[model samples]
Target: MAKAYANPDVLVSTEWVAEHHQDPSVRIVESDEDVLLYQQGHVPGAVMIDWHTDLQDQVVRDYIDKERFARLCSSKGIANDTTVVFYGDKNNWWACYAFWVFKLYGHAECRIMNGGRKRWEADGREWSREPEPQYPATSYVAAEPDPSLRAFQAEVLKHQNKGKPLVDVRSPGEYTGELLHMPDYPQEGALRGGHIPGAISIPWSRSVNDDGTFKSARDLEKIYVREAGLKRRSPIVAYCRIGERSSHTWFVLHYLLGFPKVKNYDGSWTEWGNTVGVPIEKGPGGTASAEASS
Candidate 1:
């Protein structure tokens, strides 16, 4: 078995949460895309924070800027001592992403829900209909950047044809150039309707079950190790339309499997898929984007 963290350090079950709702050390954060879903109903004592708005820096580079992210957590009353239990309606992927952002900022006290809110509700967990905004005053300190935790375009290009893994979480159609959104003005350096030269395909949806909860670590290990030939120790870069989906995977690798060097290409396909000239490989047949050399 892999080295799993203690209960307080990792994903806690809905039942466990119920038992600790009033515990001052624990805090539940609802990181849903649709605020209405959380506002309408959420686990008791849970507070809402739209993953898109409340969590990320969401500008160019598509990462959580350290200073801003730290302040956001502090603003939400999350402190170094706060043991976060993050859950969301979207299979908990975004929740995991949010949890990852905090970890990137050097906060190790956070945990994401195994399945997410849907499973919690399915299991008949007690919930609330009221919303309470949290504003806490605490200082969060961010340490050195975890360079191994991310990748940039230059690094990705170097590994393109060498079979170095850069997992694309986009749909097959998008990866194959069948439905890619052509940018308004062709990007200065972009790839056409193809994926990175040596990247593999693992649609983001594969990580989550139909009900939006993450599969167990044991099952995930099988999918990753047997199917992808990747273990917790593998050097992999996960990317998607943006960095959000990949961030979800980053959390899985770092937190669930305790992988140390899994990097997220934050710019992702949104940046690569748009570059003017780059080697691309699509299903059936492939072509290097004319833009690669331009």
Candidate 2:
């Protein structure tokens, strides 16, 4: 028997998305690491939200401001009560990231399309290359950013010092001092390799099955609880290169496993590895030391 997720309502199937994507009260959003993938064809009626351009501030490393987030939602025809469904490529990697961002803005109703684009295509669903349809702009209001869902560098350091758990959701190469980024990736985001001191190495993709759907709650518990020793009640922090990969883990921990307090470190390795004076750990031995001078 399969154990149920802590919050199964947060995940909608590709079939469910297929049926409800066109409904006026539902907004289907496709967010991908490859910003151009949506143009190639996507779930019919799905709108594109480029992770780089639409969600991020151009001049700063932060997300868009509340007013800009409201305008973006309004332009996308999203009302405060509308159910926003996020889906995309790479097992919904960027989809989960976008979902996390929406939560930070206090969006009341948000869901992820399980299996995302991979399953959508594998299921033989139809895709459309037609121009994105624009609905009437809505008067969406965004709430102030939620501090609990996000973690900054200083907070993360303090959390580490307190012996709290931090999950490093990157490839093992990046987790060790072997690589600055994922294999075959740019290898340029940070000045150094290795992970934040005391973080546990758990690649983000382990939470998902081959079809891109998340694994069952029982299986998830085996990985996170039984093996990794994560408790449901404890606060945790997850991070990847720039936080996108860790968002996937954040969803699994917080929503699926019912963890009460979990934060995504958006600054991630980019900030930690580049900044001076922070402590880092190298190799599987997990020794902590001050970051080396560039």
Candidate 3:
């Protein structure tokens, strides 16, 4: 059973938030994720960090821009001594995205809210109608972004057409090559899905519950055991449009299941499924289709 706060490595619930919102040790990031929602309202002590703009790497078009990533935490008053609790809608992708960036920069004491704001609102929790003002500027010592947590376009390029299980966590339409309104769905709806030649299509939706919290560990075990074909020794690399969803999955596999080393293709289909020259396998599960370009 996955008790939200019990497993610090995985998740935390709204109840946990209510209980600990004021703890000096715990910092809450509202992760407005969307500009509109942020402007509207948020948790009492929550700090706003725009998921798409503030949290992402604007340059290098790759993993979290190293310098920008470090600055983000410091700006948010996140010090090396702080323990972070991240929450937002978008199926926890917003929270997980920041969580991944924090991990990428060598901080490990972060947990995503199990159900985000939905749970809080559903339970009639208090909602603040205004965002918090910025705090006084304080410099946080920045560290060089760690590379082990990042996987690159070039790395995926080397693996393209290699018959590895290129997992796609995007929606079915995106996978079936349909253009979607949401640009974030899959690298702006770029990949002609089906899937990578030997890839798996496990949309990230299967991983979470209707309430937005993750399924329990036992339940998660069943999903992966049956749907994912995960083995004790299987080497898995999870990907989504621009790497955020896959980072969520990467957290699941690495922290929850204790998988040896689940690499997240951070560029994901954004770089692979959208790029013109690197190969792609467009077909259903493990169909083995490849344009085979050098």
Candidate 4:
């Protein structure tokens, strides 16, 4: 038998989703890097949440304000008490990101569909192209944004300075400063290319199987505990070029492994590599420079 996850309730199988997606008390949300994927076809009754426009603040680098978040949930027919299930393409990359955002706003009942869109498709599940019907507007009062779930640049700096565990979840190229960003994606997010000092290069994909489902808890423990030496109770932070990939790792460590404290640095490399005075280390086994440079 596979070892159980620390918080198994946070993950639901594709079969569980198929049976319960129509439950009036459950809301299925699809978020993807390719924003248009949902319009092509998605789980029936699943609503789309675009990470760029729906979750981000238009003017600032931060997420949307609490009022906007409340309006968004209400518009999506998600009441405070509704159970939210998130799944998406890219191995649920953006789905985990959307889940992180919801948690930032203190949504209590949130879960990720195991294996995401890839698994659902592989299983030959039903898909719908019809536009989702508008749900009745709900009254959703968001709790004050939780500071503990998010890490700012300064907090990340302090975390690293203290030699706490930091997981760099980007591709090795990005981690080693060989490529500024993922290949074929825009290479323009940062001026400098490298990782924060003392960060472990554990690509997010390592935690998931070829089918895009997460590895078993025993397998996960081998990777994160035996290999990476991450402790279940340690405070850790994860980051990627733009934070989406790192959010996936955050979900793994925090929910799957039951780490007591893990935060996603949303600003990530776009902010870290661009900031002039922040320290950056380049190349494999590189040393940190007090000032970042091209």
Q: Candidate 3 overall Cα lDDT vs. reference?
A: 0.67
Q: Estimate each model's TM-score.
A: 0.83, 0.95, 0.84, 0.95
lDDT of each: 0.69, 0.89, 0.67, 0.89
* Candidate 4, 214-276: lDDT as tens digits: 999999888887777776677888999888999999999889988888999989999999998
Weakest lDDT window of 10 consecutive positions for candidate 1: 285-294
Model 1 score (lDDT)? 0.69
RMSD over all Cα atoms, model 4:
3.9
- Model 1 C-alpha lDDT per residue in residues 1-294, reported as the tens digit of each score: 443431325877777888876676777888876768876888887776666676655674455577777676677677778888888876776787777666666776887776788888788877788767565667976655567676888888876645565677666766666756423323322345667765666667777777666666666666555565564555678887667778887776666667677788877777887777776777733222211221
What tens digits encode model 3's per-residue C-alpha lDDT throughout 89-128? 7777878877877777777588787788777778778877
| 76-150: candidate 2 lDDT, tens digit per residue | 999999999999999999999999999999998999999999999999999989787798999989999999999
Q: In model 4, which range of ten residues has the least summed lDDT?
A: 285-294
How big is the positional error of residue 36 in model 3, measured in Å on the Cα after superposition? 2.0
Q: Which of the two candidates, 1 or 2, achieves a greater TM-score against the reference? A: 2
Ranking by lDDT: 2, 4, 1, 3
